[model samples]
Target chain A: MNRLGLGGWAILVLAAIFFITPLVMTATFSFWEGGDRYGFDSYRILLHSPKLFESAWLSIQLSLASVLALLVLLVPAMIFMNLYAPRLRPVFEFMATLPFVVPAIALVAGLSALFTGPEWLIGTPFYLVVPYFFLGLPYAYRAIDVGLKSIDLDTLTEAGQSLGASLGQIIRLVVLPSLRSAMLGSALLTLAVVFGEFTFANVLLFHTYAVYINEIGQHDPTEAAALSVASFLLTWAAMLGVLVLGGGRRPAVGGR
Target chain B: MRSPLAVFFIVLFLAVNVLFMLAPTAMLAIQAVFDDDGAFTLEYFQALAQYQYASSFENSLILSLLSATVGVIAGGLIAFAVLKDDAPRWLRSVVTSFSAVAANFAGVPLAFSFIATLGTLGLLTKLLKTWGIDIYAAGFSLYSIGGLTLVYSYFQIPLMVIIFFPALEALRPSWREAAENLGASTWQYWRLVGLPVLAPSLLAAWILLFGSAFSAYGTAYALTSGNIALVTTEISAVLSGNVVSEPQIGAALSVGMIVVMVLVLLASNLLSARAARWSVKS
Candidate 1:
């Protein structure tokens, strides 16, 4: 029987306090109704809000659209950049990842300024996905790049070309399936990012899930807490599901 | 040997980045330097030195530096415990995935969750009070810089673990073995061997965390209720303002943020580039 060291126990306890406690507290406050009782009133209240359902549904739809657009933008560009224009790889990486330094607030400020003349854009949720696409790009590019690097893009391209395979066959049959984990990983990441995103949706006056949640918070803190827990847990579950389904190496974020 | 079609797609990708990322930032720079009539003027940049702008910038710097420092220390310790110490398998994977998740986790849900834990009527605050401590009476408000720092560190710690652990892994076990053969203590080994190897990446990671927290809006927005004047909230206030008065002022603030981030990111990039040379241990 190995006894855990005092330091090990301390780290675990600290994790409980720092990471686990806030979650437990939020979940509890979510369930804690007034008049000395615990009930599902908070969640029930959230459920009854047509605004909540409507915005959440819209957020899901926009997020799906954004992920599709991201794949369309990233995959071909990445494979072509890797296989053909290898010299431009660093420039490509820099530009794609540069937005990480720009805060969501800053991007929202810029987009609103850029879209000023197009007062029509400010009216709909359509333009909101553009910024969300930028938000997810850095991570998505990294995920796809990791996948490309794992399978030799050069060797695969050469092999496909020798067999008289078209670029479409190479991409659809050879490349994407080999990079399946990363594509799925990127899509899952986009889903998590879009639902949790606030600044872009809020400033643009769109009613995404996060914007709706903040509005709910203004009127009712308890219900907001309940919804926050649910949304957070849902994201985690999706991430866990992706890893499980991938059944291989999960796309690492910062690892080389 | 490459086809023209391949070249077009690469150009197209660059255009997307330019249109979405660089152009917006350029708009910020232009707005910051130009007046209402579109002629060049430095008024907005100059306004950055005033009390409203200067103070918020200062608050952001102070908060980011302190939070990054504390987060690096705490996170480094946890990463060491999990990686070097042979902790349980379950614990390692949990910390790894949680760090990845929490690293991306930001904005309102994060801020409100902290409020649920430590706000005036918060659970932790209540717990502290039961133990004969009144945080509010002692001039501790979760709406202040101190409280914001506490919340910022929560994500920062996990982020450090995620980004910093790779370098830790890169420190070949042979280095430790060699250090021990030279009669070095654990502290000596880290100081003489590990510290030098990691210093650059550590600094880079710290800068990344600082930039992240400095420009962060949602957590500070919800926790401080926009009363506090961090740069993120300052910019957010103007951009989200109902009236279209002086939109360039918000652009000026964002330009300030971009400048700081650009400098820090450049320095971080140089440092990491050097550090990568060190990690080519194979």
Candidate 2:
């Protein structure tokens, strides 16, 4: 209450308005009864549609698969970076972030070109999983890297060695447990991104969750609005959950 | 113990990353140069001189620059207001949180929401029509290039805020306090101490924002429905099997985009490096 001045207030108010405008409009339009009638019919229609449920399932599966793959890839990679290649950390970090900076369409287009034809992996759910890994890599990598940095990895490893623990046992018992919060937070964030991602899903013609938004947009605007509201809530809830659970964790080891 | 298995996994990870990340981009460049018949030519690059393709490039660059500039200015203000100014703690936190969410909010959902608000049958449009103001008739279409920039700015502003906040937080509090204690005005204190310290980061962040806006396709495609021929949508259209069925042309367009992205990435890296040095010195 004391820190923010008039200027700050104005900015906050303006930002809130801008951010909420779309969500509010969508909710209103979805609920507004007009022409024949409305009420909750739009939502009802959305609920009854088998395609909506199917897409939701597909989205969940894809997100879960991607999250699992990211954990497999990132956990070891983070540990490796922490133990050996600290100097190359920034380069690896930059590479993970490359997908974000590149336009989504362009990446999809390039990927489509590279993998189309008899070589076409575009139709496979597994291919979709690949790009999802790239998209989720930065967040997961940063999260794990941060977590790994906070703990004394060298001492822990040595201590485990002295106790006659194998490398696998040491990683599982000492490292993995220590990184629980970071892993949870990163997984949640990755889920949010993969769930909402549309560009690749659309281009690849996949039945992921975001495809439902596009489909509803074309066929039923009202239903689409309802779906958007649901999505906004889902992603928002996931993000908040992560923050609440992982907020108090220490910053990544040696993080500025 | 630095086991051989650990070394093998590390090498394998790096090699796999290079293959996946660099292969597509390299393919783009290779396709741009060679036809299906393996004939190398400058035909695609020459096509850049044509009005259709040239205009798209020019429009993409201009729109990206404008949106990034506007986004950074607005974002910087909000960041400064939250971090440096005597703003309300709750209000600052709210703004920060909202911006983080909104920054990630783009593409179809964003476009659809805007259409609901401002399109011909939009909520605001209907309200304006009731007031006898035909906003559409006044030549304001939400599907135009300018309209896309406006929509893109919505997300970009929050993105800039996110990127710039940490850099702003790195500013020493004593610098501001010192300036204020010397009877300097608020504006002068910021101008002499804050802006100089933050300039490099600002530039780096603006480039990053520019790159993001430039490459963005979802909101642009959804809002404009591929009618607005920016580089991203151009590539999308080509790949959608619509305009150019030839994968080579789609590859060429993608290659062009990667070139621009790489250049932007390089510039941003250099700028960030400079900013890091300044931060260390201060």
Candidate 3:
């Protein structure tokens, strides 16, 4: 540890505090007792709050739907871009980065305006999923693009085609396996974005886990903090899950 | 190139992009310029002279600049610390994964974590007070521009690591060795070779961070509870029918933000084009 140098150790400590402090404080605070100060009280509180379950389950479901939509929409386009539409790849790339350029608040504003006529859509979970899909596009595209880029995707396609393999088999047996790491990375990233999202969910008035936590924070901070810890852990698990389990060797498609 | 299924998916993707991405943007721009009367007017843009709106713009600009600057430096240091060969490989992987998660980990819960960490009655604040310094009484409040910068920098630093990592990882140690072989000192090599190689991307990265911080809404909103008047909050205020109930003006603020982002991005694009040329040379 001493051999790691002052600069190295300093950075390690900085990261530890920055990453862990809130988590520790929140975990400890969540179990707070106004009467005695620590137990399973917060979890018990969380258990009784059906709104918590409704919102959390809704978030997970919506996140799954969004991921399904993203992979379905993105993977093929990613494959097609490199394989056939190389000229249009730049245009598509520009479009993918659009979400980053546009502020999330602005997106909420514009989207709300878009749905001002059909106000009913505002209340639906899947409507949130649509914008959520758009929200995840930039990261998902970058990750999958890295995954697609990691191997000689174009050459693999050509080889598969010439060998009389069907396109379905090419995507399934040829592409998906090689793009495994990218797919996993993209999936986790998309899930994390959807799960942690607040602006769109709040503005759209949908009760995703983040929105629920924010609402709960306003009233019961201890419980809110517990939920925050849980929220962070869920995303962290997804994150570390990808890092540790997604790849057999080093992650070829590192975070973008 | 033109398989039927591929073509269908491409059409679907384009349709969704147009409907969700392009169309909403066009709608927002229109609302910013037009009024409830459905006629063209610059009243909203002209009203930027108002204190509430203008301050938000100014605050956002300063906040993003400060955060991005510090974030890049911190991120660079951590990237080096973790990515080194002798350092624990687990820590490196954890850092990389954490950045990916942390970069997306913002909004409400993030704001709560910050409050617990550094709010006026925050744990760290109280902890430091015992050591002879009262952070809040020293005029450091978590509900101000400084606080927003602190929160923004947390996410911004990790983003810098994520964006900067691939490039940094690709830089072979042999380059430094080769430079040393030519009698170049560490500082000399970095100054002459290393900095030049990385200069453009660094600039590009700073701009990206700038945009990220600039557009950020949730953290600032949750932390300040509408106390800080960054553009995003101002837009939210107007949208929620709080200070000024004019949705058009909110749209105008949104437009103002979009304009700033466009300019920043255009500059980033220019820097990246130059960056491509720089990389090609080596």
For candidate 2, write residues A1-256 as lDDT tens digits.
1256667768867876776776788888888667746599888887888998888888888899999988877678768777777787787777777776555666676676576655455556667887788888878877877788778888888888899999899888888888988999989888888888887887777777777788778867777777767776776688676767678665333333
The model with the greater DockQ, 1 or 3, is: 3
How would you encode candidate 1's per-residue C-alpha lDDT over A1-256 as one tens digit per residue? 1135788679768875788888899899898887579999988877788998899899989889899888887788888888877888889878876787787888888877887756565677878777888878988888888787777777777888899998878877888777878888888888888878887777778888888778877777778788878877877776776666554664332224
Per-residue lDDT over B183-253 for candidate 3, one digit per residue giving the tens place of the 0 to 100 score: 99878977987778788888898999999889887788788887778888887777677774688887788
TM-score of each: 0.94, 0.92, 0.91
Among all candidates shown, the one with the greatest DockQ = 3
Best candidate per TM-score, number? 1
Scored against the true structure, residue B220 in model 2 reaches a CA lDDT of 77
**lDDT of each prediction vs. the true structure?**
0.82, 0.77, 0.80
Q: Give the worst 10-residue stretch by lDDT in candidate 2 chain A.
A: A247-256
Instruction: List candidate 3 stretches off by more than 4 Å.
Output: A1-4, A150-155, A245-256, B84-86, B130-132, B278-282
TM-score, chain B, model 2, is 0.92
TM-score of 1: 0.94
Give a tens-digit lDDT track for model 3, residues A1-256: 1136777889889877877777777677777767556888888989899999999889889889999999898888778777777887977888898887788888878877666656466556788877888888887888777777777876777888899998899888877776777777778777877877887777767788888888888877777778878877787788786676556553432222
> Which 10 successive residues of model 3 chain A have the least lDDT summed?
A247-256
- CAPRI-style grade of the A/B interface in model 3: medium
lDDT of 2: 0.77
Q: What is the interface RMSD of each candidate, in Å?
A: 2.4, 2.4, 2.5
Residue pairs that clash (backbone atoms under 3 angstroms), model 1: none
